[model samples]
Target chain A: MAIEVNGKMIEIDEEGFLVDREDWSEDVSEAIAGRDGIELKDEHIGLIDYFRDYYEEHQVHPTMRVLVLRLGGKIGKKFHDHKEYEKFLYMLFPSDPISELCKLAGLPKPLPSEHDG
Target chain B: MAKKNDEKGTTNPELNIPLLNELEEGQWPSFVSDLKQWSKTKPQVAQLLNQLEESYENRWNYWTGTVLNVSGYGGGVIARLSEKADKYPDLAEFHTIRVIPPPGFVYSTERLRNLADICEKHGAGILQLHGLTGDALALGFDNEGTFAAAEELMANGWDLGGSGPALRSLQCCVGQARCEMACFDTMKTTRFLTNHYISFLHRPELMYKFKIKVSGCANDCANAMIGSDMPIIGTWRGPMQIDQEKVAEYIEEKGVEHVIDNVITRCPTNCLSLKGKQMVVDNENCVRCMHCINVMHKALKPGKDRGVTICLGAKRTLKIGDTMSSVIVPFMKLETEEDFQNLTDLIDRMWEFWNDNGMDHERIGEFIARVGLATFLEGCGIDPDPRMVQSTRTSPYIKFEELAPGLFEGEQTQQPKVWNREPDTREPSD
Candidate 1:
């Protein structure tokens, strides 16, 4: 399916993941968020940026477990505890934290085999 | 649209049963009209229609050249749609339907005809009466016409069976409905639970498929003890009723050896004894198998003041070996709506605990086994009791902390630290 972002048409798959990864921009993420009934808040944007940066560096989306460990061990400025990070993540996105993050971050839907725990 | 078997003239057993149209005039009336009326609000009818149509289309491909391969994670209705429906004209829009029956399945001829008529109008005019789950399945249909067929089915009052990791239709024995030995209302309990958890029946987000089966008494006609995730068994707290006059008559008519060899000796627990003319029952030792009662139906009967014994974590082997449910609530009266609420609450707590902690594809029984029974009981607000003991090896072992000063030392005569109670150590309320 195609979504119009600032008068530019961008393609996405049936599940709403970005069809052409290079076509993604902030405007594209906002359009996707609009379709998902979620407003792209400052916190969500920060998390999405973090996921994008992580993906760009590693060529793979981080699982929830890796995200928690990274936040607690190295990226400890915002949240030091894994449990607190999880709580904050859920506070931002109630259902399906990873799915929402990937959608906004322009990442493929994580396979069911991949654990979010 | 019946598929031809290798034997050209053979009739399909699944499709050919007691036909609805051929029944006697006064026996039962057609329910197709009733089904159409009921279809207005139920959304599953439309969904099932789409699935069945897809399945029929897939089957056509299988018959011609392509292999019908349906693979997935969840268990529910196994729908097959042709992968290359656009390429093959004959395969387009076909679908299959599998329907699971409720516990103690008893359907009138009219009801069977209603199902058959729905299939005949929309599909290949075939029905598989006894599927894997003992459910009725309609084999073939096309996408364009199946919706109307499903709507009529719903109007006639049929719900899809449970599939996936949700609760299956709660199975129960024919309890107080007909049986004299029944301790509780099995039918009422089954209906209430089925209706209350209907959404859970369709949704498959849980760890795995969960089943609840109820038996009116320990005879376990429903086979709940070994098969279900949760088994509710009926038990009488009192002794078995014995008619001394009938016992005396039996002794005189049949001889003392017969009663001694058959009824008294057959008690599995050795709980029965013949004392002169009276038959004595050690109620405490009785397993309630109904063996003696079955042998001497006229002479013996079940006691009054009946209630249910709830067991948990009984299931077939998956990750662990096969295990029978251990008595959770030894006994509870399942009478009022409040009592039902309590039962549901217990179930809710168990589901929440299992869902939160259980791994992907793990069963509730497996979760209990992994976490240990003590942890489960403590999490569910149940106190540790002797009745809750499952095995000597796995039972809760007391960890002895260092005794306080003067306890079990020097001439201190107070009760040992083991017997010392905590503030909330009282037994759990029924």
Candidate 2:
């Protein structure tokens, strides 16, 4: 999938997941981070590697609950705070223009489709 | 996924709806409004919404009628009807339709046609094929042919209803019957349970919504506990195979490395123990989660004494409060249908108590939890089992002999920043 983010078209990698940093335009990173349900921080840039490692091993993104559990276990911290997690995830993928960001990152198409109708 | 956005512009008379925010969710879900928004960006989704909305359309009569309870799945249809209003004059006002489908079976296409034909002529063609599920829906059907459609479906060996409070078709995710994880034959037990309880299903006395989910070796793909009022979980009761025995060699063949570290260790019980080229499960510590078995499928096998744990006092949802689902039948061998029938008899007694004094449509969990557990047992003339009762829930925590600092030094992490502000208050302890 390709999208014109910030006036430049970037192609999503073959993994059906975007990997290139240059491709991660401000909006794209925000959206991916949002989809991952993580807060975007400079520290989170390395998150791509972590996600890659997780995907390499599991062959899939950790679903929201699984991600939280892994995070809690890895860091020995409780992910009991729901509001912070939700906000952090959104902070990475601000929904101001969700569609544009989702497209640039090559996320799966939204649930309902033309075929469904 | 629940969020519906606006479509860009192609406004059609049918799908044009008002825009609704999260605030209006409790007030009214204006699906039409949200679809209007989605159509602006994703026109196709709006089209699908229209397709689904048509179920509410065209020449319907509303008859407020109730009938004797036939099956527990019957209540879902009632709940569905309770959701609708008299506003949709285009749809037939079918107050009720008897839910009779094969117990623990799904309907095929041809049978669907016959049921549709029958319901179309006699009752309303609105066949809501709502079997037993947590999120069962009320789908629109043609009233004219629904009865024939139901019949047609039955003729082709399709089931419409079976799983409810009455008896459910024991379900598993292609367990040992096929999957590498199952310790024994799950399909055998499933068929046995269904074969034994043909009469209990239609009986009204034991009619309570219940579901029994069995995920052969844990990896709870079926989510048995969350979805069912009475959850029957599979477990083994012997030594775990941790040595490089016949199955341990297949651990790598089955790709059991990465999952072992994550899934096995996550077992709330410390039942999973690992050795060189071997993975073992602790019979006494195991809580039927099957995580260890799932993670190390090749190295692990359930013991010969394989059975199910029947947890009672449970419900599908706890949106209101902490509903009690207790371990009633702690263990039962699946060798015969008699075990399944014993479970059914217990369920019938539970239903009789709830229906007799439940006051208002109080669910089984609510009714049992409202009155003391003792009262429920006394009413049903069931002998109390101290081992399986509610008070025995205890965590198996192993405390290592080490300094707490050594154990906890790497535990510190940045705390989450909370945004919801609150008025200042001080605690006496603080």
- Enumerate the candidates' DockQ scores in order: 0.08, 0.01
Residues B1-430 of candidate 1: C-alpha lDDT, one tens digit per residue: 2332222213211221123223333556544333223323322232333333444655442322111111111222434444533333334444555454655566778888778778777665656655334457665555444555555666778765455445665778889877888899988898888777764553334567778888999889888878888899998777878898888887898888998998888877788888888788899888777888877778888778788989878876668898887778878999999999888888877776676578866778788778876677667766545456454226533323312334445774543233233334457645
Candidate 2 TM-score for chain A: 0.42
Which stretch of 10 consecutive residues in model 2 chain B shows the poorest summed lDDT? B396-405
Worst 10 residues of 1 chain A by lDDT: A75-84
RMSD of each candidate?
A: 11.9, 25.7
Where does model 2 sit among the CAPRI classes? incorrect
For model 2, residues A1-117, the per-residue Cα lDDT tens digits are: 554556666666432246454455557665554544545566455444455456557665433334333443344222223223433433454431122223333343222111100
Candidate 1 C-alpha error for residue B115, in Å: 1.9
Q: Please provide TM-scores, in order, for all candidate models, with all chains considered together.
A: 0.62, 0.49
Off by over 4 Å in 2: A1-117, B1-14, B17-89, B92-138, B154-176, B183-217, B242-260, B263-267, B271-282, B316-324, B353-358, B378-383, B389-430
Chain A only TM-scores, each candidate in turn: 0.82, 0.42
Residue range B360-422, candidate 2, lDDT tens digits? 334567777677655776687764454555544552111122112243557634332221123
